[model samples]
Target: MTGMTAEVMTPKEVETAKEAAIAPKFVTKGVDVYYAEKQALTNVSLDIETNQVTSLIGPSGCGKSTYLRCLNRMNDTIDICRVMGDILLDGADIYSREMDVVHLRARVGMVFQKPNPFPKSIYENVCYGPKIHGIAKNKAELDDIVHTSLQKAGLWNEVKDRMHEPGTGLSGGQQQRLCIARAVAVQPDVILMDEPCSALDPIATAKIEELIDELRVNYTIVIVTHSMQQAARVSQRTGFFHLGELVEVGETEQIFTNPKDERTQGYITGRFG
Candidate 1:
């Protein structure tokens, strides 16, 4: 046809563009947090889209985890922590009195920095949430949930024969994946992970990263990590936090290669963090 230019798009690129056009899964506006008058997060606004991985990256004590806690109202557990702002999940206010904290948390499940599997069998650990939430109507139903969750977390094959063994008996990586299975068993719409691989060995870390990539296909995932390389590798969108503030947020490649803010550029480039 004539002289023309065309842009090549990969599968991930196409998915990212599709999600960008949809309404975000969660929207936070002008959120602020204080720990007994000492501010931990400044006015922060961000959006999380569905079926995608969004990463929060920054140095130590930069309020990344604090901001993540806000998603599921985890901050409310602390007596000294106060959060003020509008955070909406699926167009409803998560902080409203009309919302039940228990149900809200069920909808937005969390996996912490360290693997904190229950002191129970692996099967029990995965079924704990569904049992408490009454998500299963019978033993057979609960069994199915447990099986599917473990399979989704990529741990079923290794632990199927040892389901009755303590979750702590598994390797560190398996324990983390077990915790992830527990989270998935709840049938949550969003999964929040705070440094899910911080304590794992390289092989374990790789497995967790692979799981994260797969999990994003069904659940909206948000991860906080100190590893910039991990963030670049896993996230479609990345947010950079600095000194209790969100310095910048954009596509992962753009944030890594061409940050608009000086603070973001500095952090990503190792100039200062």
Candidate 2:
């Protein structure tokens, strides 16, 4: 399949191509966010293409995670966090008062920095999302979703015989993959990951990276990572954030080899974080 192009074209040509090309699954425009009175993001605009992995990289407190949370409205859980501007999913603004937080989260799922599986069994953990979202009509359907999700996550072979075991009992890497399987159970259109491999070793990290590549065929993925190598390995596109602003965004190869902005160059070149 042909990927989306950043080539400049006339308005009419762009419109025609846009119609022919797969539209962005997510669009954020002029998005500003604040925690209490302190601004955390400033006029951040971007498009997350469908069926591709997009990585957000930068120094700590650069608003990468904050911007990610905004996609699924996870910031709504924080009382002091306020957001302005628009975030659209398939052309509808998700921040609108009419949007349902429960439904929105199901459509846009998340995996945290540390794997936090439920106390339940592995099978239950994978089935929980489908159960909560009412995606499964019955026990048979729930089992099918659980099996499919685990297979997609590349964990089915490892844990298929131990479905009744507690998810917390698995190794760190296994638990992380279990979390990914749980996210997939709901059949989300987009999956948001916040430093998903920060706790794992290199081998586990490699496994997760492979899973990320496979997952992009079915879900739009947005990852916030501190590891430059990890970002380069997994993402199709990369966004560099600095001081609460999105400094640059381009193909992963371009961002690494030839950054357009000084700040991005500094970050990637070991001059600064």
Candidate 3:
């Protein structure tokens, strides 16, 4: 008989191996988008890992946001927009006839570039999703959801005393955070941010970046950002889009320091977006 020694793995090594074995949260392949005869994205394919931040970077009108919108079927709202390809969430086709758009959107929440809060109070803003989704059967549950959501978004301290105030009354950053809390209230599995800090000051941008970092521990995050620095800062993986196609994708450090594609290097070096 051949002798074999049993191998023991450290906790960190076991966790790493488990993560490597887990399938990506989202798997997109050969995605193409068209709007009124204009092609917006061409053969875009990428995998969004679970519990990680993936940032899509590209110049304006380069289709990064368009591709992001496809993940949640947001493009379906446009009358002339058409998307083709496989967008799988946990191995299930998101575009299949059986998929519920409302439920999908709830599972994959979104925060826009601007802070677009409702006219309702802060409490109402955060509670709306739970109310609509029937996640809370009573007032106490709804209140708890609001409190926990705000806390997770890092806005609880600022808004605890102002729960009854209009959500629009908050400042730019606060409103954005409130919007994040609103999204978080539903307990989504994924959060998609479209240039989430574009309209904010540097300080506010930093806060949002911090929140993004913290949120990834519980939810997969995909952000479309034009700022290379922001992408480098907040994302564990970075994908670069150019001329409606994904040029390269890799670990953030490699994408920034040693790009595999010249186009990515050019864009990173500030030659041209």
Residue-by-residue lDDT tens digits, candidate 1, 50-143: 7789999998999999999999999999999999999999779999999999988888999987999999999999999999999999999999
Judging by TM-score, tell me the better candidate of 1 and 3: 3
Model 3, CA-based lDDT: 0.92
Off by over 4 Å in 1: 1-21
Better of 1 and 2 by TM-score: 2
Better of 1 and 2 by lDDT: 2
> TM-scores across all candidates?
0.92, 0.92, 0.92
Task: Return the lDDT, model 3, position 98.
Answer: 100
Lowest summed lDDT window (length 10), candidate 2: 1-10
What lDDT score belongs to each candidate, Candidate 1 first?
Answer: 0.91, 0.93, 0.92
Which clashing pairs does model 2 show? none
Could you tell me the TM-score of candidate 1?
A: 0.92
Candidate 3, superposed: residue stretches over 4 Å from native? 1-21
Error of 2 at 219 (Å): 0.5
